[model samples]
Target: MRSADRVDLVLRDVALPHLEDGHGGAGAGYRVDVAVHDGRVVAVEASLSLRGVCEYDGHGAALLPGLHDHHLHLLATAAVAGSVDCSDATTLDELGARLRAGTPRAGWVRAVGHHEARVGRLTRDLLDALMGPERATTPVRVRDHSGALWVLNSAALAALGPLPDTPDVERDGSGRVSGRLWRLDHELGARVGRTAPDLAALGAELARLGITGVTDATPDLPRATVDLLDGARRTGALPQRVHLLGAATAAVPETLTVGPAKIHLRDHDLPTVDELAARVTAHHRTGRPVAVHCLGVEALVLTLAALEDAGHVPGDRIEHASVVPPALLPRLRATRVQVVTQPGFLSARGDDLVRDVGAAEQAWLWPWAGLRAAGIPVCGASDAPHGPLSPWQVIAAAADRRTPSGRVVGAGERVPASLALGGYLTHPEAPAGSVRRIVPGAPADLVLLHGPLEAALAGVPANPVRLTVVAGRVVHDAG
Candidate 1:
């Protein structure tokens, strides 16, 4: 082949996404060869008569557009690598042993994934006893599994110095600080001192999982955090393209694209409907859409009301529409707002929901098929650190809706495997819209799985990826 016909890379004998049947079966279509050059697909044919600087035999495996995690906390996901995970602890002793064994970071022991169901309600006194006398001087902060609350030891409270005068800071009957803070991530971080975790490892993990892009949905991100993410992307510490949803005033660097303005609503401390509507309008006036965090029915109702009052924008989204009662479905559909949900929550917290939530409410928890059938656009996300990070695990959860205990939470909510996979194939800006396909002139970000689409979807392998390419550059190869 002439130099004009040469390309940067070519993937031979791979099945494309369009060839997959609606039910996850491999439809009748001959495997095709794809040519990539200058970060975009240049040619695709039954047999590409072209030369490539590098070539790989796909062995009739499925080649798909790289996955995009629609909503997750990038910094928290990276930071979780160093924190003790209390997710699997079933008793107070197990939780205490985990926290005690964890090494301290700057004399602070940070733990995450704590559940009141498993270890009971945590307080400063309980944490003090859990840490024991030897480590009494060390401060500790344990985050609830919901990521909405934080229980801190007395040492942790004292280490932070003066507390902010906010109702979020809980107090006991004696008017003493109870060490349980609700929806105070920013306040706590400011007092604790912010530290950006290295993104190199996180980047590699994402590549291994075939993720080519992500949306950092951390609300009201500080300027420092924005700069950190931009710098990481530029330095290739984080190679995946980023869409950052942060403070309205955040001056986004060119390295990162600005996403929808994030509006976080807590049931315990919700803004009035009018106030929330004003906030939405303010962001919309500046030509930016708003992505509201609504984990409870109350918050969801408030958010829907606010959206109706403020009117909707093209990219406006409802993040984690975690509890969508059937009554609210019509209202939600009327708003025409897209929902970016985390199916991983079912696998991660479904059992807890079964035990704690009322049976009537449990049926509507993270409704996937219900939302889709209602004509409401929907997308899947990991919501990492609070939920599982792997998109495969998330996809499986969407198809099965099975909890850790092997019980199906919402059988009616389960969607086909192809539909679950389609969630990750969507463009970040147009999530809940059409899925991106491996066509000529599209970005060369792609994943080659170990087997065909049918086999991979059926087995849900832990590491199904055979190779991952980002912008015509090989980022990961299983070999």
Candidate 2:
């Protein structure tokens, strides 16, 4: 903790891995002593005799750059973490029991990860019927796998007040409002009470996975949520750095720097070409790059077209370009857009994707190698709550491409463990999706793992993180 000429901290006898090729190849990494002073890596050499206020003997563990998630929904992930997990419920009775057992916030009970085939046709009527009499007044919400649809009970509808005749709110043929919502939970959730997961606890969870920073991709983040995160970060309650991108335009606190403007485009709700172009123009005019959410090929094509017309901006981003056809790769390369995707999705939903997209197109689904070959920079993200949050698990998935069903997806797109890990590195200027190497002059944000890089990446006992330092501050120390 010493300031001035004395080093703040010193990591001794640490091995660093080098990427052989910029595109998924590994090179030999040598052991070095990394010294930090005033939150920046001051020195990295084979040996150093300089003394420091505090020292951690690496014991030949791999010292890698800290992980960064390019696309995350922190608040949503936190909310889901605290909700009743319906992810594994297979029967309607099981789903009902799970919902009934959940602790309600105020008078509402929320559950995520419900599939129609498993839970039967999820409808307001079915939910109300399942509740019967034990929970007639308790509001119930069941969300789907994609987080796009929500089946709400009658109690929830009443609690949220009169539903306007909006396109997002689903209604029956008889003018009766069905308690089904499409991408409008944010509005409905506001009516009910809000229960936020402990930021400190969540930060600790992230630190354990060696995550040092995250780019929150939640659109139109509320001011209250921003204030809550900022306070936690300032007080050291939240140790990870947070970068936010939302639809609302507001002056954020210094703790929360302004990020790109977000435009969400889904398959069901397609925006006209003009509408899309207008949004791109508006964000570009305000000196902000646009981050578009595209999940399907249809959405990807439309988004690419808009970016093509709008021209390339330095920081324009494509969130979850999950399906980029080979034919369209050339168009995407022509733009300065960066693809921030979740390779973990292949592990979580690979079976469904392969089934939907068919075998031929499945090869292009979440293609890391194709993007790299097309001259497009790709960054990895958890898209948490929707996907897994473990950095090591995600990296392994990127390398293995093995799904929960033991099926290999996009075999040709599997990246080397080094390049997969390098996807998280952040650059100073283009901080959004750029990769940085672990060298002197870089911010001293790093993680110390239990073994060599290759062994860790191969999932051999899954290398546990021994220490996590963010901006030179020791956030997590397992030792």
Candidate 3:
């Protein structure tokens, strides 16, 4: 289809009603007429004229604000979406079946989703038993994000020789070469797509999922990847706005509301706090916000300290405060920092969290309630490809707070659905726990659900994205 010459389209659905204010205010829905000239939104109206190439349809669906996956690895996630996935393989037998059937190749031989903070240990012997000498010379490896790895057979071990030791395999009764790989899965996933991705393909997929934007967290991933994405956007090869976090380059803007610094406070430290703090301070001095990536306890402190030292306040979002300690909760809340969290993983981890990390930390995992009570800003996130990137699922996970096995680790930590949506960093300066309602003058970024917001969120597991509109363009018509 060619680009429209005049007013491009009008999309409307029965359920695309305006969000109700909840004070006896009537909720209203508008028929969105998107005027596009040169592929950018010129006007969005309840009704408008069409000079050429007009399309009108929302098909009795629902429409709301466009969704965003604030934390994601664009290139890697896109590539992993196609690789041999064993994320469903729950036990040794299942993993073995996958290993035997897939064959001996240097290509990614494994796919795992269960977070390492949950699935604790899988021995090399067990992995070897799974391979059954079929590829004793071939490599066999498995990994999780939280610094644990299990490698089986000589080939796999040799291939992984250069990687750092892992507690799952290397942890001895005392301390020595235990032959295990720590957080090997996460490492492998990060390594999977060192090659450049087709950003055009990724952008298309994002629109399909009701996503109009992304706050890319994988900053040090590869310069080529972001360049491709940025180039694509400039050429209209990609439509979404990319907020790339440049962890290595000096070209990165110090203070940016849309694009900010990507700092990781997690296992396998790389960049120093002083470096991060400098960037935060630079952005703060310029009156802009920076987004950070923090997944572990220690990293969180480093991030907190850097921000405090710089005298920078909380527009600096410490996204994915997944493992913050209770002691730091108040400090995090008291500051101007906000958080973007993925409760779905916590829900998926279930009892394994207790088994691997112990009860206390598991209970403190993704502490949403304490943050909210302390007025700490927080937003819901999917961290897609690792978690489903649907806002409904994110909202439900945050509200329900139940793991895959029906276990609730810190039951009291769940936040309300409304509050969870409020924290999305998709839009600049949007407060935590607030919705981007469709108002007349607002930019036309809308999504439609099949039911009421509350009910739709609760039913996300049963349904997916219904319709997605970005900058007034109906990019996704799920029906």
Candidate 4:
């Protein structure tokens, strides 16, 4: 902490960019010199003279803050490993070819996007038809907007035996497991999946995308997962800061310290007002904010009620606040819950979203505007394999409000790309512990995009984020 000793690192002559300015700047964007000491930004300005072993030349490149995946299933995405991709087809016929050609093993057969009009409604009839005699042998699942299920044919059924009443199943006239399932949670046991990428490797992956940190979602924060990350940190492999999150209902783990609890009452439908209120009250008393997984409108309403009853106030992060029914806006306005969403959802599932939910159902898609207009603070996430691991794509989806075909679904809910960056670039909602913007006093968490901001956001055509840096470390170097 000596005055003569500048800091551990400094990023010079860089153009720092921000999604928005808070308070003083009203979304005041930044692009300038950045100085880092130890691990924190010491000062950010146009020019700075500092003595440090390591330095990054901004060269007028666009530097952004760290990106966070506020509400995500990163483990699931990671398990995908970029291999089996069903994200492109507009019809099941196309998917059928892909499936029959080289289906990955036989575990949970899934179709990413199946539009109703194009492919029609997916019922047990389709499952029976697809599986046919093999339904007795192979287990398959198709994932539409409504979720998915394993098509357990007779052999598969005999193997597993009578099914449980989870996911609100749709049965045939004779009243048998239809395989056309709803709510994929109940049928599956307490399945906790995580892709524990090598710490050094993960650091490199995140850095390439310009991410400096991420808040992993979980029921019980995976000790093994964080342990791997911790190991990476010790070995200089871990790339960014991490803010761990555990389910509110979980028994806190000792290995991790200081993080929010993840709440997902919508899928499981537990945590009545009393239960939620009690939990929030207790957690707030602990002096920590709770991040609720409320992607449905009904769930969002109930969440607000719980927060209010618990005597909790603003700054409590609300994840996936996508299903806000118009009526709830005024009420949400009265609270301090920050509305966070996965902007990448629009394009993530490709045609599947439109297929499963139908355009009418997608009328509100990832309602970014509704949240912003209500003055509810909002943030963004890539949602990864479910989407992609890049903020630029989120920005493109947010700004364009359309699909790859140039068709708009939730036009009214779109946010300007600049503003959406707040989630990926500025809002604390994303990159929980990730770096952001190249500014002095801030660790160099930056992205070198191929083009300028406007061009990067011009939809599918532009290539963004050629380089990513975190804390003066070159995670992704397009150069």
C-alpha local distance difference test of each model: 0.87, 0.80, 0.59, 0.58
What are the per-residue Cα lDDT tens digits for candidate 2 across 1-479?
A: 22245698899999987653343455557899989888889888877876778899998888878988777888778787678888788799998889888888766788998877545778888999888787888989888878888889988888888877876788889888888788875676677767666788889988988888888888877777788888988998888888888735565787766567878885787988778988999889888888899999999889888887887678888889888888998998887788887889888867766766766788888778889888888867788978888877778888888888999988989887767777766642253343566777998899988777777777765647889999998999998
Whichever of 3 and 4 has more lDDT, that candidate is 3
Runs of candidate 4 exceeding 4 Å displacement: 1-10, 17-20, 23-37, 42-56, 90-92, 103-203, 218-238, 247-258, 267-272, 348-363, 427-441, 448-463
Candidate 1: segments with Cα more than 4 A from true spot: 1-4, 19-29, 247-250
lDDT of 4 by residue, 1-479 (tens): 44467566666665554443431112324556666666566776666666666676756655556665554444444444423444565576765555444353434343443444555566554644655564325544455533333333343344445666654566776878765555443233223121343446555666666666666654454455556545665566666665566633243344223356666564544568898888788778877778887766667878889877876544477777766666777877676676667767776543555655644547666777877777776767765545666666777787776665667767788777766665665534433223344444555555656545555556434445666656556667666
CA deviation > 4 Å runs, candidate 3? 1-6, 12-52, 57-61, 103-108, 114-130, 145-205, 231-239, 247-258, 268-290, 324-327, 357-363, 424-444, 450-455, 471-474
> Best-fitting candidate, measured by TM-score?
1
Q: What's the best-to-worst order under TM-score?
A: 1, 2, 3, 4
Give model 1's TM-score versus the native structure: 0.96
TM-score of 3: 0.76
Q: State which candidate, 1 or 2, has the greater lDDT.
A: 1
Return the top candidate by lDDT: 1
